[model samples]
Target chain A: MAVKDTRAEDEQLNRFWYRYKKHTLSRSIVLQLMVCAVTIGIILTLYPQPTIDAWIVIGLVTAIAIVSTIVATSIAMRPVKDLSSALVHISGEPTDLTPPNINDSYYSRNKLRPLLKQIYAIASANITDAEAPKSSIALPNISGQLNHTSTGIVMMNQSKQIIFANSAAPISIDSNGVRSLDLIFDVDQPIMEWLSERGEHDIHAEKSWRRIPNKLAGESERRIFDIHVSYDRGSEAETIITMLDRTGEYQPEDDDLDFIAFAAHELRGPITVIRGYLDTLNDELIGVYDGDQEELFQRLIISANRLSGYVNNILNASRFDRRHLKIHLAEQQLADIYDVIADDMRMRAEAQQRLLSVSFPPNLPTIAADSNSMSEVLGNLIDNAIKYSNDGGSIEVSATVNGDFVEVAVTDYGIGMPPNVIANLFHKFYRSHRSRETVAGTGIGLYITKAIVESTGGKISVKSVEGHGSTFTVSLPIYATVADKLTKEQANNTSLIQHSSSGWIKNHGAFRG
Target chain B: MPIKNILIVEDDRFIGEMYVRSLNKAGYSVDWMVDGNDGLIAARNKPYDLMLLDVMLPERRGGEILQILRGGAQDLIPGTKVVVLTNFDQTEQARKDMEQYADGYLIKAEITPKKLLAFIEKLAASS
Candidate 1:
């Protein structure tokens, strides 16, 4: 029975040597061949002489062969132990890496003893560290490189070690080091389970996460992240954890409940006044025969129209919020639109005893824009200027073409905006805190104007002082083409030709045309 | 001057019909045109003692028609006493900026039909 057991053991050892020989030590194969060659030479050099010295030399050759064979076997098996312990280190599992009968084997005193000792030491060191907090793991240094650069690697493992983090990660994680993955995201069930499970998770499926705290510009806020889980292919128990920061600025959704409430509030007063006027007009309490009564009806109509303008502005602002505002691009003469708006507002300006003036550099290029929108924009600006101007102040509308861009400025010499109000003037429903007492405004005109201008790929900026006036400058790309000018000229010629033909017909007695 | 006939030019059908109904009850012959173009055609085709003109018309806006008349585009409608009706009273100040255009300016929203009838009667008596 002992002989059969020894045979089975010998078979296992032979298989193990063949398997790990290439991975562990193919270099020892050449060493064994050289040792065998020297042994054979020593045996051949000693003839079959019946002498004590010859016998002694033969004994030395046999001992050398045995020692060389033992050295080769130990060299081949050392790395297998190391590989097994590495797997155990990653999994947090106790590994049985001791070679059977290794201490009783002939190669126990070989150089491979030290390698086996190191692998055992490494595996045993992790036994007590099983419950070590992941946060205490060695963290990488990642500071001062956030805004301009990003490292593309992300890592998480079952060994509780993570690596290759950029500057934003430490700040994002909100801890000194990684905590238990479960504890970090325990609020999100799917994410916690996904991190524990050693497998890749689809970001769409595992998107829920615990909110991480962040401070931006002295304000505290929360950041969200999407964790992607992956496992090391070489070992099933090992895992990789990666976090992606999905945080961005807050853009309020249109149709937000608060925004709708704001809209309703804005329209309520104007609509009430309009409805009241209509009721009075229907009642006709003023008798039919007075000349002054005719004038009163006219004033009612004017007020109704003014109220209509406010409603239209609110609707436009809502459209802007929805991102549904579309620009109708057309080749339009900027100077002509400016002239019409300035001319339209001139009377109102004068009514307040304020001055309104417009100037255009001669032969300024025509801009491609929606004519109605341009007129509306200019009209609102000029009207606001007139409304906000002091009794004796002036409002100037000026435009000039400069290097492929046209800059139009509306300057009002009136009570201007403070820095805080000016900063938020383009925000929806933001009324100038200063102008609230002095002016009657819906606070939507400038917001709508900015939206319209930006929708056309133009930019608007303002400069203002508290007690002086504000200057709003709009810079639009000039889109003047030779073809457009030619077409315009052709249109003018056609109209002129038509006029001359009509004149000729009238003079030539063609039915008195 | 007998106040038997009156011409009304208004773009809005509802307002024009209202004017016609109100003027006919006041014992004046009323003819209504829906726009400036038709008004010009009707004015040349007949002699009316008074013409009520709306300054903002749908087709061929009232300002264009006025420009044609004041610039000698038509002779038969010459010196027609025109009373301008507009939704925007500020437009009176605007119309004044135009030379030799509207004879008089009236706001539609502020006036009642009865009041408009009296004003027309007075103008007719003066003429």
Candidate 2:
């Protein structure tokens, strides 16, 4: 019975709409004809003795009158047309109806006020039906799950004001009772930047930040969070940021370390092939090139060498981070190690228009260190000197004996660091803000250099004056001093002596000396 | 004996060709294999003076081949020297295991053609 009543009401509405449109159209046509006649009558009055030009003027005025009347009629009938379409749309999809305000004066004085009232009644009923299930079932369930989830979620407006924050969000309300994203995240976090940069286009971005909050409930631990930011572009623009705590869940061995090692290993193969080809080319093409061509070939070899060094640095840095890097300290001739790398260093320095000079005192003692690691340390220091120095500035590598340690210093007359920059120089991924733009570096070179130096019971320090120059000094324990200490600690420790005789140990006499 | 005959087992064709060209230029007979299976077959078939084996290979790993050749009841070719040349940085245990069966282990990235020739010449002179 209800369905039949609805169908009858719809049919009546359609009939009323059709009749209203016909009445409006006929009225518009009559109004336009009257306007045209009046305009022609005025034109005729202005020119009683009508000539061909006067008749033409009357015809143009009549045409303009007809057009203006049609436009005005359409403008006046727009509200009634809207009402008819609103009714049709509501009948088709009642749930999407937006009821008109009955209290508005326009609707009150409208010719289709009854139709508007009918649509309003149907709209209210359908809206109630649509909202009932959502309020009863989905709202509570969503809020409950959001409150229980470990991951913190926050939604913000374009101004970065927190619109909605879940229970897991580490938020604090200010005295004004306003909760903001600033209270939950640090100022350095990229989430705030992302929110501020929100545009009409959608954005999806993620970053990781390490945070250490104050003790809460007697528990204080370092937490690493991977923050995900998503922006939705629409009339109601919003940004959603989610923070997933990855402190306990992060497994370096299973994830990024292995990937770094794998990638570095794979990269080494190609570098080897490239270097091999370059070497063969150098051998076969020796003495066949002019000065400029030879310089270019030399630069090519230097770049290949640098690439190989970067791969090694990445692998070693990953290994050092995991404490898997093994440094077998033995008596190593510092001269031999330096000699192996000096030619490459010289080429690198010359390529950049810098002079490199190596000076070592004769009869220098061997140092107790890993030859490969020592080479890396010296290479990193020299590479830094070459990179940081200005063109034509000379870089000097020299050694000095200081007590029981042999200090190898790499000095460059170029841009240097201030005390503040030097303070965090050894920290991993800490590149000085001043040099970050002008200099190209991975920021892990010094970190790995420091670790390797310390692992071998050596020390690395730097002295610099901003805009003048810098000097990096690495002091390694003399081989005899370290060996003596080891022998005193363990008289039967033959392994140290035995290990020192392996390859690259050119000075066996240093053990007895 | 001087290293007159050499076998190179490398997957990368460019690197293999480089080794072959350099070694052949230096008047050493060379056999290049692109995979571990062919390499092992060739090694078992004939006794080359020196075998340049790569660690990461298809069909069989350099470590497995080394174990099969050296861990057998009797040596396949008693005096043939095997040098493990690779770019892979093995773990401590894995390296130790491979080092047990190989005469020498070298990083490929650290050794150029000239350096490898020098190393081979030194190995030949020592033997």
Candidate number with greatest DockQ: 2
Q: After superposition, how far is residue B34 of candidate 1 from its true place, in Å?
A: 14
Put down candidate 1 lDDT per residue, A1-513, tens digits, no spaces: 999777755633234434566544555655766776786676667754447876686677766766766676775565564454444444343434434233545436554455556655654555433323133222321122222232222444445455344443433343676543322321123534554553454222223232322222123343434555554433322343344554452223223423643564445344433533454454565566376666555555545545554654665566554344545444456875564344336645665688888888888886755554666677777777777778889889898777777899999988887787776677545577666776888667887888788766677889999779889888776766433653575453221111110011111111001
Segments of candidate 1 deviating more than 4 angstroms: A1-305, A481-513, B1-127
Best by lDDT: 2
lDDT of 1: 0.56
Error of 1 at A139 (Å): 11
Error of 1 at A473 (Å): 0.9
Q: Give the CAPRI class of candidate 2.
A: acceptable
Question: Could you give the interface RMSD of candidate 2 in angstroms?
Answer: 6.5
Q: What TM-score against the true fold does each predicted structure earn?
A: 0.37, 0.59
